[model samples]
Target: MKKKITLLFISFFILASCSNDEDSSIIPVAPVAPTAIHAVLNEGSVDITWTGVEGAGITYNVYRNAVKINKAPLTEAKFTDVLKNTGSFVYTVTANLDGAESTKGVVSEKVILELPKTKTMQSIDIYYDTKYEYAYTYDTSNITKLVSLTIKETNTDLTYKKVTVTNTVVKYTYAGNLITKMSYYSVDDIPRSSVENVYNAQKKMIGRIVKRSDGSINYTVTYKYNEDGTITETNDARDSGVGIYTFGKGNLVKYSITTPMREDEYLAVSNYVFDTKNEPTLNILGFNFFVNNSKNNEISSSTVITLNGELSSTESSKSDNTYNENGYVLTTMKTLKVSSGETLQTRQTVITYY
Candidate 1:
């Protein structure tokens, strides 16, 4: 009886030992912390990445500024945090395994502020050859208003003859961001000519009046718009002629001018072909402006005009524009087909940003 009892005890001890060994083998080990955490700053966001933990069923938890940001563990090794404003931030990542969290791996970054969507032009410098130039100045406090324009002339020859500098200064006034009046002056400070512009409630130009310095109206031009947001007609008081305009595909395709009494007498006619991305604005001139209107800033165009019902002229032009790192137009070169049957360099414009 004593031998049988001893044998039962030994069997029970062996069974208990085997059960403890199996439980020890099944116990999970905590995962190691992620290493080599890296952070990259982007416009209004931050991108973070780290070396993945080596184990089965492991995930990652992301923390920003020592606070847990993600509610659940991520299955991948990368994360992107969108910032509400421009500022500095810190991030850390930890490896998670079977409800166990490891130590964190850390990184820091700064979210740069985005620039304003629109910046009004502050100044313009026009180079009419090397000897003559026009420098336009604006009130930067109100970028929509141009204050003054000065014409400068350079003389390289040392001669006793006096250089006649006329119409050297011009003053401008604005009403609600629109040019309301402009007055030109000679070098002696005497007024030369003045122009007045009138606009409707929709900010569309309604009338333009040119006057001599003596305040006598020299000529007047009035404009009317169609329902589709295009200029339908213009009346010129100087020549007693009216111009009719027709548009196709949101572009001004043709225009013809005629006197009121003579319906068959067409003074002039012009037809234009625009690029796919043209936004016609009177603020700038040339087909290059149409191409510059594109997001890519590249364009080519052809135009034809008639005088007295005859094909008077044809022109072809192209423009190439380059941009700065901030996506602003840095420089542009325009080439035109001249009467000499060869391409001539017409204009070059450079822009500076604040």
Candidate 2:
């Protein structure tokens, strides 16, 4: 951290004699500097505060790396730089008077910019069932790599005899630039199943192997790319299923799954509509490596189920969102409904980036 100290400057008022050569009584006005300028990292932004210059009619002007960043002389000794990129930064502040900026003092602080690493998804179910929280650990040595993730879940239903809490931790293993596996464990130290990825000689992932806690094979999924650019997934487990994923404009637009339901095979189809804005959670490093809702913010989605090719049930959901200037989602209001038009529940989520 660097501090820019404003040195006291005395502007001498030159006393000049009139034609009579008599000295005019005059005094010099000294300009005061702010005590210090402090820039601290806060929630992926820079918070800058400076000790006020003790005087009336004096304001403050903030500078970043010698460039004035504020549009007007600030009445207060504080400024917040909402950063859009990361790098080393220097901040300075000086008092202002009569449209003139005072000299900046000599304390300097260097701030290293960090990528918006953490996103807290604080969600409240309008229907009150569960709450979810997640935090990710960044490999500080190489910040682009996400090392681990922790998830906290709470049972919010008061009808339950007692509420329960569960904690899950996920760790990632990578091979070069590709993510190879993700392992899961409980906070209490209980181990869970792990999923391993299978890649072809071309470094393209072709399948995934799920393993039991004891290292035995649980199930496997194979992937195939279609000529039309859609992808198909075959699951050897889970009632022997097949799924097709359709993509559009860098997002998954539709998905359909076929699985045996009792004696007949049922088909579940889902469709999604996305906004052009970038998804907020996807800003986290290494998150885009997963096959999921990462490319764009989801606006609306629907799912339909058919038993033996006959219509069964249908449901749809929509999201309303507010975003920061960088186009990252800051808040989302979600609503869900059934085919009968009965509202299921509403959910609100606020995301903070750190």
Best candidate, TM-score = 2
Which residues of candidate 1, in runs, are more than 4 Å off?
A: 1-132, 140-144, 153-167, 233-298, 338-340, 343-345
Per-candidate alpha-carbon RMSD to the true structure: 12.9, 14.0
- For 237-276, candidate 1 gives per-residue lDDT tens digits of 6447776666665455666666544444445555555444
Local accuracy of candidate 2 as per-residue lDDT tens digits, 1-354: 123222212112222224234533343354567766788865446799878877778888788888888897799978898665556788888887755667885444776553444444444444456666777676655545668878888777655546678899888887765678888899866778799987767665678899988889999988887899877899889678889989888798999998887799699999999988767545344345455444788889999999977899999999999987666677788888889998877777766655
Per-prediction TM-score to the true structure, in the order listed: 0.47, 0.65
TM-score of 1: 0.47
TM-score of 2: 0.65
Q: What does the lDDT come to for candidate 2? A: 0.74
Which stretches in model 2 have alpha-carbon errors above 4 Å? 1-128, 201-203, 281-286
Q: Give the top-scoring candidate (lDDT).
A: 2
